[model samples]
Target chain A: MSSVVIVGAGLGGLRAAEALRANGFTGTITVVGDEVHLPYNRPPLSKEALAGGVDVPGLEFRRKASIEDVDWRLGSAAVSSDLAERTVTLADGTTLAFDGLVVASGIRPRRLPIPGPQEGRHVLRTAADAHAVRDRLRPGTHVLIMGAGFIGCETAATARALGAEVAIVAIDEQPMVRPLGAELGAGMRRRHEEHGVRFHLGHSIDSFVGDDHVQVAVLSDGTELPADVVIEAVGSVANVEWLAGNDLDLSDGLLTDSAMQVATSSAPVVAVGDIARHPNALFGSVARRIEHWNMPTETGRRAGATLAALLAGDEPDRGPFCAMPSFWSDQYHHKLQSFGMPGIADRIELVEGSVDGPCIVEYHDASGLVGVVGVDRTQELAPYRKQLAARAG
Target chain B: MTVKVFVDMDKCQHYGQCCFEASDVFELDEDGKLQYVAEADESRRDDIESAADVCPMQAISVE
Candidate 1:
């Protein structure tokens, strides 16, 4: 194989390129991304960057020396692909052929189709979005967040820290209910409330009312929230449009085997990062697209090895990919960290400390311990992470 | 061969993610602050590089 093209210039793309080189694949690599900037740390965009300010250069990922020669085609997106011809057409009308393809297009923030003026509504994803939202956040401003997810809750905390009034309206009973569970999630909501953030739980924003900018957020319960800005942190949509017409499972995301090889692809196509719904042996045979920050590094390593092997006309490792998914969230001074899929657990027990302060929560399914969350106990999470990462034969 | 490893004290968030990759080279102190060896055998380069890569703050540097 002489060439490889990686779609999406995020952390995943950078790692994939680095891995390709590390695996002794001396092919020319080109990364195509819609965003003009290279891969940057995005988790800070909601916390420090949101409250302090957005700095694209400061947030950019540090590339290893191995991938320095990789071509970066920024500012244009991959419009479509022809799997049979091994060609990808970019938005700039350039068609590029590759011996191996890395489907790392990642995801975009999903916007709700609510009746509202688009003007003051925003979603936190890119550097530009963070900067734009930060510019509007100040004292006397009211930010009505429309989702109770981590992003929404973090934005509430950041907005509140900026001296802006923050109100969260969501359909869930508590903030971060999906991952932290109702009990612990409620604890999180209380922490946010203690910091001057208001929660209108079990409510949805009916619409945003104003002539130009959002002036009021009408909740389903008929409570109208005065809003200077509305942040919709509902979820994300996989950027799989470019892979359309290809005979691949683009249902939720690009379905891949445990080896990161695209399922039933016409060529040596491998999907990685957030876009690949691959199974983990540690979690069972169920393929899940974990949106955690570490998934890109884990999947990219495996995908790069798989693609490099396939390009070399060699068989790839059939070993089960059992990466322990993890993510962290900072709201105010409290830091919440998790290892594995706590959302999949049916039972949870507070193993140490109280919910109001430093604590370690263990999540379990009928099988056994499936996840662990550490609240301000970062040092103690390593053992639990290793436990979740242990693969069962 | 020996490699020099450095962690920017100012930029480090002490998330302890690097400990998982190169526990021998990087570890959090009792106060949950990051402490790492400045120089190590080159055989540990792979582990040190992985530790640097996984750092969320991008505060680790190896030479």
Candidate 2:
């Protein structure tokens, strides 16, 4: 009987496993993971879970009742891969052979290189990270958050919701300026201000001051703000160090074709989720890497189904996966959803609704066929998604 | 019998809701990467189809 060995039990890996079973593969499957707990969701870690409204059990993808059958090798990490031998080497000195392999090792949150006082600083990346931050959220606690990215904004919202005074200091002209562009970010800035979240735009943190009891946040311009806690949400780095000597494309992640196959024709390993970067046909050779919750499931499903067909000696007819990229942020009472990439929007054209209520904002690029961005209008996003798919062809 | 399934790693972020829809094949590693048992038996077709259906990105395709 043919056996499949998978590495990294993250969202991508789990989806592949489920896809394979759904596709009707009966071979023995072994899942090796580095985390002690089973595969869970991460989006909630920054929202409801961080706000103290939801618990870990409620956020788990696999409940206790459904974890039967299949071999789950928890707390195991894959250290190396051999393309010629078709083997995966784990950190515990075990070798596992595979007819097919899927590499789903995701990225880890970036941190400050120099170690400062580790008392109040927090970075929300996993369930453990969220739980730690939750413990620090007390009434009247002034929190200082670095970076105006999605996680940072969500943390600010969560902190404010917890009745803690929150202040965001970012280096950009506005929060989310890079990803969401300046105009939309201006809207977000106003939204945050309305919620009582203070913003120090176009500034960097000079240093952390004082010992508890509302420390001061020294800014680049010599301005000082008082805070009891600090949260950092700069960004993340892909876990591709293991493939250094292996000769795989590792610019941002393991480079693969649309099929998610790593290396050239000489090698045939599957790469999925955050650790895989490839030129998106829809985005025109953008070579993007998606680190959201929805992307992994789609990629894993395709990888799993493709692997099943290949193992069965059938011609795999899987096409390059493309979709309107969408993600949601639950901040205060407003649920912000941004669909498609709005990286090149000259201006944000409010098509329908209002930011005060559920609204839809369209971002138009030079070409003008909706280059990216459909805000708050999920149902209206269907047209743009279709347009992007058609353009991909 | 053969089927069609596609995975665009660039578009996939690796959240495993598909495992719930079809656990016979999808599994995650200790590092949260996606791993799977390909070549599933025919009896499991319904589950695999369900996973492809529920995939948020529609990154999954069945033929």
Candidate 3:
């Protein structure tokens, strides 16, 4: 029987495995990952989970009642992979050979690199990290957040909801300015400040102080604020170190074609999730690598099918996996939904709804109508999904 | 037979919805990262395709 080996047991990896099975492949399939826990939902990590309202199991996409049959090599890290030999070598010195190889290894959180930074310093990428931050969220505790991105905002909302005094230190003039652009980003900043989160904008972090209690956060502007707890939601880096010596075209990530096939070497390999940087025909030939939740899950499934076809001696004929990039965050009592791709929004207009009630913000690139950001209004963003898809076609 | 599959790990958040849809190909490791068979038999294409259709990032690209 043929064997298929996958690295990284993330949403993309798991979905790719399931796709192989559903495609009727009766092969020896093996999955390898580095985490010690079963795959759980990450979106809730900053929302309900941090609020102490949901347990880990409740966030699991696969319930215990509906487990799948596969060689689950859990807690094993994939140290290196040979694209030529089609084998994945685990950290334990075991190697799994495969007829096909999929690199679904996701990203790792980027932490603050500074002196005296140790435990108690946190990043909210996983469930455990969220729990740690939640434990520190006692009423009246002072919380200092680094970065004013989506994660930082969500963390601030969670902390405020738990009655913690929250402060955000961002390098950007406005929160989400890079992603949502300046105008809409300013609106998001106002929303947070209105809810009582202190903001120190356009400043860089100097260092985190204290040996045990994390008492001070020093900024480049020479401002030191007393902080009871500090959470770093700065950003993330692609986990592509394994391909350092390999011939793969590793720009910011694994360079791939629209079909998600790695555009390097004669060996057949594909990359997905945050580790992939591929071109999208929809956005002025822009290459994108999105770290959101849903994108990888869908990509993994599609890649699995494409791989199945290649193995069957059939020509892979799948089109570019293009879906309007969308993400939502549950912060405080607000449900913020961002639809389409806002990476290149040159202008944002308040077309419908209101910031006082349900609101929608449409972003137009030079080509018109590229993205939309909605507040307390998911339905308003639904219609644009089809429109975006049509634009891609 | 050899097949090529692509996964954008940056887009994948380790959620395990794909495992339920195509167990033969996808599984969750103990660490909770999603793992999958890199290749599959030709007959299982439809199911794997469906799994990809459901991915949130459109992270999967097949050739």
Candidate 4:
């Protein structure tokens, strides 16, 4: 009899447990999570959940019949781990030994170290964060967003919908330049601006000006913006501190092989989701951790299969792990859907229509077509997805 | 094992991700809305399961 411990009870952990059962692993599976709530959808936390209200129970992931018996140790975060001893110590000092380990600890919002009044500060990551932000997003409230990524842009749209005066301050030239290229990103910025959202591009928050609550936001460019509620959607840091002394690659996230295995054979440990920097054959041999909505199921399925084979004393097939990363963003009526890594593209050409309206964009590097993003062009994307996969494969 | 598939339309975003996984079971109509067959063959269980799993909104449920 063997037991497996999976850290993080989000989509990644839940899928890993289901994958283990689907692979016929009848061992005890325990999922330890920092959050009290079970695995729920986080995307809505910035959009619908943030706008209307945070529905913690309604946002939960549907439990597959196979993983119904998994021991869900929620609310207790993993404080530390002894990989050599095969034991995990929780925050409450409870130590549990396991034969298998799955690292799905995920990430947290990265906050800038600017001196500020913390009372009106917020980050849209967890449900609680969404709830807290939602309370402050009343009509006519001045919402100052600190990032222009998907989360920041989405939060801006949500705040605008709630009648909040929205303003985005970031160092990027466009809203999503890193991922959607300058043309599309600028197009998105135009759309946001049309909706009354102000942009403070190429600026950083120098410090906050307030006694207790955030009354104003002072920018690096010496511009002062009145901010009633400050939402920091800058980025995220991988939560890999628990496995600090394990001698694993924690530079950005935990590094793993294509099979999601943390090592060759020292232990049966695999990492998944946002924490697992696993290599994808679709994007060369670069092991990058993607924070898209689909990576959990993709990596968890692969990780579970690898762990199950190891536990059965059989060598798992060492095939190159390949998964087409897909993500969709809904701000206002425009639905931005994408397949493949658009960020790595050197050339971005608009194939159909204009950027402000419905359009399709192709992202290509020197190698050829790398990704495709379609706005309100859902039906036409299937062919592009297949073509990209075949070309990359 | 004939799987009974039920999709909560209220929750469906019509992202058409499920159509990629199980094209025969879930399809996006001309209006780009989701339309699905409630009943599917057991042989297509893996693909249907993948369809339900890949759904961004998690609106599909197969039994």
How good is the docking of model 2, by CAPRI class?
incorrect
lDDT of 3 by residue, A135-155 (tens): 888899989999998989998
Candidate 4: regions farther than 4 A off: none
For B16-40, candidate 3 gives per-residue lDDT tens digits of 4455457687665765566777778
lDDT of 2 by residue, A1-393 (tens): 888887878778887787777777778778888776677777767776787654655554542222245687878788887767778788888888888787788888887642234567778877777887898898898899988998999889888888999899888898777666676678788889998999998888777776543378788898998867888888899987655566677889777767676654433467778887855666666667877666777677677777777778775654666754556665665545555666655766767765445566767677565444434444345455557657667
Candidate 3, overall lDDT?
0.72
Error of 4 at A301 (Å): 0.5
lDDT of 1: 0.90
Model 3 DockQ class:
incorrect
lDDT of 1 at A207: 87
TM for chain B in all models?
Answer: 0.97, 0.74, 0.80, 0.95
If ranked by TM-score, best first, what sequence of candidates would result?
4, 1, 3, 2
The lowest-lDDT stretch of 10 consecutive residues in candidate 2 chain A is A59-68
Q: Proportion of native contacts found in each model?
A: 0.50, 0.05, 0.15, 0.70
Alpha-carbon RMSD to native, per candidate: 1.1, 8.7, 9.2, 1.1
Descending-lDDT candidate ranking: 4, 1, 3, 2
Question: Alpha-carbon error at A316 in model 3, in Å?
Answer: 0.8
Badly placed stretches (over 4 Å) of model 2 are: A62-68, A210-214, A264-267, A344-347, A353-358, A370-376, B1-63
Clashing pairs in 1: none
- Restricting to chain A, the TM-score for each candidate equals 0.98, 0.89, 0.93, 0.99
lDDT per residue (tens digit) for residues B1-63 in model 4: 688999999888889999988889989998899999999889999899988888888888889
Q: After superposition, how far is residue A105 of candidate 4 from its true place, in Å?
A: 0.3
